[model samples]
Target: MQLVVARIGRAHGIKGEVTVEVRTDEPELRLAPGAVLATDPAAAGPLTVASGRVHSGRLLLRFDGVQDRTAAEALRNILLIADVDPDELPEGEDEYYDHQLVDLDVVTVDGVEVGRITEISHLPYQDLFVVERPDGTEVLVPFVERIVTEIDLDEQRAVIDPPPGLIDDRAEIASSRASREEA
Candidate 1:
């Protein structure tokens, strides 16, 4: 399996080290030196990591043969991919690959259908389920343990316990409007 590990960001300094927006949970294993990764833009890499460091809370990597800021600047915005065993899974029971959750039905605890999981949004803080509703609108459901109660792989559904005003806005909107009228 080919999984995305990181995306190359701006050139950090004049020393060929480029800032990286790491995608993997296991960056220590995936982004270490001597790890050769493929790139989205074929010209940017097949990059071999010479060294890595953490500067100002971001990952910085110096690739082999990319010896100057000019060379590093050319690699901006390319995604890095790693070769992995297809059968391998993350160690944690609650963890999952993005591919595994796509296209599943999203429902409330009471079995009320909310939407269909179209994509997984991997933000810095958390992952979100980008769900498409029956009417073609979309909603972002945070993929948190407290809200997402179940993930049934066989049944192909995700059961959620959404907080107030998450799945629906009519109630909150109506309440605000009534308050305005009272004032």
Candidate 2:
């Protein structure tokens, strides 16, 4: 299987280095030197990583054939893909691949069916599961260990222990809290 690991951003300097919007949980392994990555447009690469570094908190990479800013600039917005084994799992027990979480059914601990995970939104600090409700509405559920209690692949389900107001309707949650406080 092939997984998208990063997107080529703007050319950094005149040194063939380009900024990357990293997509993988293990950038060190996926975007390392000598790593041959497939490109989105298919013409821009099969680029081999010559070198990589972190500059000003951003990931910068230089490809083997891309030796100048103009060449690197031409590859902008192209996605870099890495060939991965389907069975390959992350080193951490708590870690899960984005593909594994997407499409899982979501429910509360008490078994109230909430929705189905339609996408996994990967942000810099944290990841979120985009759940689509039966009514076609969507909610962004933070994929935190505290809130996302369990993931059962066999059942194709994810159990979440949502905080008060998280799963509840906005007006209902506020009104209920207000009434309780008044009493």
Candidate 3:
């Protein structure tokens, strides 16, 4: 499996050090020094990681042979992909690879069909599962233990216990309010 580990950002200094927007959970293993990564454009890499450092809370990397700011800047926005084993799993029981969750059916605790997992949005604080409903609408479900009650990989589904307005239309609230006013 080819997993995207990071996206190259701007050149940090006059050297060939570029900041990266890390995408994977295992950056230390995937983006470490001496690691070789493939690029999205297919021509920008196979780049080897010459060195890496943390600068102002961000990760900066110096790729072998990329010796200048212009060279590093040129690699900006390029995605770094690493070849991973299909059977390889993350080291945590509750953790999962993005690929494992994508395409899984989403359902309510009562077995109401909601949608299918379409994408995983990795935010700084939390992750979200982008689900595509049968009607073509999309919902963003926070990947939290409280909301996502269960992930049954064997059943290929995710069971959620969404708050009242989280899944249902908010217009239901408005309708009830209007009815009470009429009464």
Candidate 4:
């Protein structure tokens, strides 16, 4: 599978260089001279990395054939993706990629299947798992260690307590807040 590693922001200087917002933690490991990277799915050819270096907390990349400000401006908002195997990812125990957790089945401690995870939102304090139920209701579960007991990526399942009425209470609170803001 192809994973997004960075996004081309804008032309940094007049030296045919563009600033890249690095998404991967191991930017040095991923960026290299002559490395192949894809921008979009329909992108004709992989962009060859002529050179790359970190400057001002952002990755500065110079692509082959892209010279001058006009050429670099054309690459703005292009996402850089690399072919990566999911199994090759390094994850510690109880850690998983946000993409992997999405679409996984969720169950309770008693083995009762609740719903399927549709999305994962990484908040400042904790991660939130958005589970979609068969009845079309979405339950936003907090990824707290106390609430979420276990996560089995291999089995594509997660065991969570979620607290009684926690989902409904949060939904009501959100609705009320929205109404107040609209007033």
Tell me the TM-score of model 3.
0.85
By summed lDDT, which 10 consecutive residues of candidate 2 come out lowest?
A: 164-173
- Candidate 4 lands at a TM-score of 0.61
Better of 1 and 4 by lDDT: 1
Q: Report the C-alpha lDDT of model 3 over 1-183, residue by residue, as the tens digit.
A: 998889999999898999999887777899999999999998999999999988887999999999999999999999999999989989899999888999999999999999999988877789899999888888899999999999999999999999877777446678988999999
Worst-scoring 10-residue span by lDDT in model 1: 164-173
Instruction: Give lDDT for model 1.
Output: 0.88
Lowest-lDDT window of 10 residues in candidate 4?
22-31
Give the total clashing residue pairs for model 2.
0
| Model 2 accuracy (lDDT, Cα) | 0.90
Rank by lDDT (best first): 3, 2, 1, 4
Distance (Å) between predicted and true CA of 135, model 1?
4.0
**30-148 in candidate 2: lDDT tens per residue?**
99999999999898889999999999889999999898999989999999999989888878888888777779999999999999999777787888899998888888999999999
Instruction: Give Cα distance to truth, residue 57, candidate 3, Å.
Output: 3.4
Per-model TM-score versus the true fold: 0.81, 0.84, 0.85, 0.61
**Residue pairs in collision within model 1:** none
RMSD of each: 3.0, 3.2, 2.5, 5.5
Give the Å shift of residue 26 in candidate 2. Answer: 1.0
